[model samples]
Target: MQLPESQVAVLEAASADEATSIDALAEATDLPPETVTGAAFELEEEGLVEVSERVDETIELTDEGHEYATDGLPEVALYEAALEAGADEEPVSMGQVIGQSGLEGDAVDIALSNYARKGYGSIDSGEITADPDAEPTADAEANALEALADGAVGTDDDLEEVIDQLERRGLLEVVETTTRDVALTDEGVTELMGGIETTETVGAVTPDLLTSGEWETVEFADYNVEADAEDVESGTVHVLRQMSERVKDVLVGMGFQEMDGPHVDADFWINDCLFMPQDHPARTHWDRFAMEEPSHIDELPDQLVADVERVHREGLGEDSEGYHSPWDEEFARALALRGHTTSLSTRYLSGEEIGEIEPPARFFSVEKAYRNDTLDATHLLEFYQIEGWVMAEDLSVRDLMGTFEEFYAQFGIEDIQFKPHYNPYTEPSFELFGTHPTTGELIEIGNSGIFREEMLEPLGVDCDVMAWGLALERLAMLTTGAEDIRDLHGTLADLEFLRNAEVTY
Candidate 1:
């Protein structure tokens, strides 16, 4: 039978009576170690040879261990020094022994402790004395070091205890190595008895062969289908970033335009434009992160500011009554890290930089927001929010609910429940919830409602505008079945979860 030269060499080296190691085969075949390993593996796969493995634990000396093997252990040095000082007759000062031993710092303590433990010396009243019958000779630790210095020691029960002691002292390490032994199988014996032929085969097609027109005449090596291939790792997008892209894709597919704004924004757009009062509890120092530099925004439109002030002081028109509280312009102009991406919606609907707002236009933003929050399993100081608004003429609560149903359907979530909620900006507000797949408990995913006239009139939005602000982390947690928010995005993020989480929808 025809065979590659390397494979034929390996099979001939292995014997039916006795198994030879792969290294021994390599030496007999006069082939490189790597070439022999590859050939042996391929031959084993073909049922021509059997490869057996044995793992052996061996001990080897580190730099510190080799030093001790040459100069002797610190404790031994201390014991020898005490004996030379005639400590057996009268106690020698501990400082004098340590100085003579030439050990410093923690090594002094190590030597003293070990010297006493080995019964080589004793310390009392701050004085050191060598044991009366102690003699200078190599101990088990020194013997173990000597053995390791020559070659690795394997499975010697007496030497193992010595090695463990040395390892604990940080002098040596125990390492396990696997040895592979290859033997000829019955099929291999039969093939060799029948006589095998080794032919010269081309290892690779080179540029010279193509140029000389010799490719057609030369014999090409057959590809080894059973051979191990090199590992190739392609780059992949981070799972969290991928999830955000999927959210954008779903929103874009539903005819929504993306929007973005500064993470640090003026309080006007963040709260005032949303009909939130200046003295709202959320505006306190403990709940929000206020910025120092660029302390307050001065470029806000004077007319819109006046309109917001009037709306807060009085009602928008005759239909509603305002908060009737004092409006502070300085508070509206103050800067802070936005607690939600609704600030972007506030800017867009106000038609500030986005030009005139026309009916039937839908806008959404998936961006990071910040809060002065306590961190825990479910809360992060920073997180992503999905804020969206649908502006159309003659819209109703039914339209808002239908938009939510279509949006959530893309995630394979069919069962959704809406509970009546209250927000200053939306009149018919709702807390959107979905059933947890594992626990069957309803978890709130988002909040939504039709915009109140008090909020939109200041922004010059005349039509009905349905708006919602949802937590992107909550959505990701539900989709990925993550029990804790910290496991998804923080210093505590689980590498296994991120690596194994499959992006869905």
Candidate 2:
């Protein structure tokens, strides 16, 4: 294949200097590295050069390439030169020259026509001339005059001139004519350049140069400094953190004490104590990230273990019989990154004073949790959870529903529905659903219900404890219209979005 002119130049430079690397040849010939390498490969393949694999690649042009390289220009350049010379000296015949030169048919015709029109030559009797010496008349004016002579009434100006001439000859009569022109006086010119500075003493009032009084004044009204004005300051809170805090505040206002726990905990507290079966699907490697170096709780208090075993093996009096598999103490002791905020609730329930608290001991927690979930528009592998629980002797499912209704109403989520859902821990469970304003589709916000005796009995809590939670990422998506879960992390949490975003009450 014929290489670009630049590549040919690089080949010549490489052969002359005995360059070893394509980079050196490129620098010497001022060509791109790719161009030098490609040209060198082509030259070697064509028997024009011998390439050797030394410490650095080396290339040498063969005898044939050397001979061609010494020539003034390639065949293409020669053809180009001939075409340019023919175009300048004489208007070459389009058909004959195109046949003789073997150039593009359209190119030859265009060159001949362009040169002829520019007075370089003319196409006379199908042959070009160098001395056409065409006239200097403007093409536009010539076309216009031609049309006017043919009674085409070229333009409005031309038609108006013809009408004036006709009226002068009595062939037509003018109904009316008007002309006007405006010009600036010398005073106006001076005023425009330096601006008029005339001033009137307004009761010897001193100008307040430091203030913006001049720009603030109305065009035709007197300035009044005594006008009453009110100042308003924009009030806002950190959006994500504020929302979490607000949820915490609402829970606190309802007499819930805040609960805290570590981000890492053993599976027994998170799963086993909650009555999640050992062989449950959620405990598999696909759903949970099992720690490589698991921390074993080899000596868990015998009382707690006995209570859990009894609650699981027997019916616990509040629910049906639990899974009979021997609890894997080793697996239970393995440390894991907390998968949900509910783990905090379980930790709180494990304390000795859990049962002795007042009738309704409310507790709330807001913290980050991790999972092995695939990242998507509405799902994040790591996010916060707004969780709370209320334990009371008479706390019923209706009370839990009422609490959620009042809580969601603060954010304008007045319409909520529930569907039956099964949670390993919560019996008679229900998944909370909220209506999307735009799509009118019910979105599952979270799950909630009173804790089963099987789950609470293990922790020595005898009263019913109502628990509810919602993923913070889902709430953010609804609030900000952000589709990607990853966007909620890092720098995308700009202050501007938090400050200006409209929050409906």
Candidate topping lDDT = 1
Task: For model 1, name the residue pairs that clash.
Answer: none
Q: Number of the top candidate by TM-score?
A: 1
Per-residue CA lDDT of model 1 for 336-363, tens digit only, reads 9998889999999989967888998999
What tens digits encode model 2's per-residue C-alpha lDDT throughout 1-505?
A: 3334553454445442343566667787788876566555545544544445434222233332233234311222223343545644656654454465454533343344334434434544445444423332332323333443344543478656644433222233334322211123343333334643322213223366226465344232123355335566477765566667767777777788988887878788778888888788677664576677646545565788778777777756654877887677777787778788888888788774244455558888889887755333455557888888998887888998999888877766777889999998897899987665645566677888888888887787888899987876556555555444444554234344556555443
Error of 1 at 471 (Å): 3.3
TM-score of 2: 0.51
**For each predicted model, how many residue pairs clash, with residues at least 3 apart or on different chains?**
0, 2
lDDT (Cα, 0-100) at 274 in candidate 1: 92
- Kindly report the root-mean-square deviation of model 2 from the true structure over all alpha carbons: 32.9
lDDT of 1: 0.84
Whole-model lDDT per candidate: 0.84, 0.60
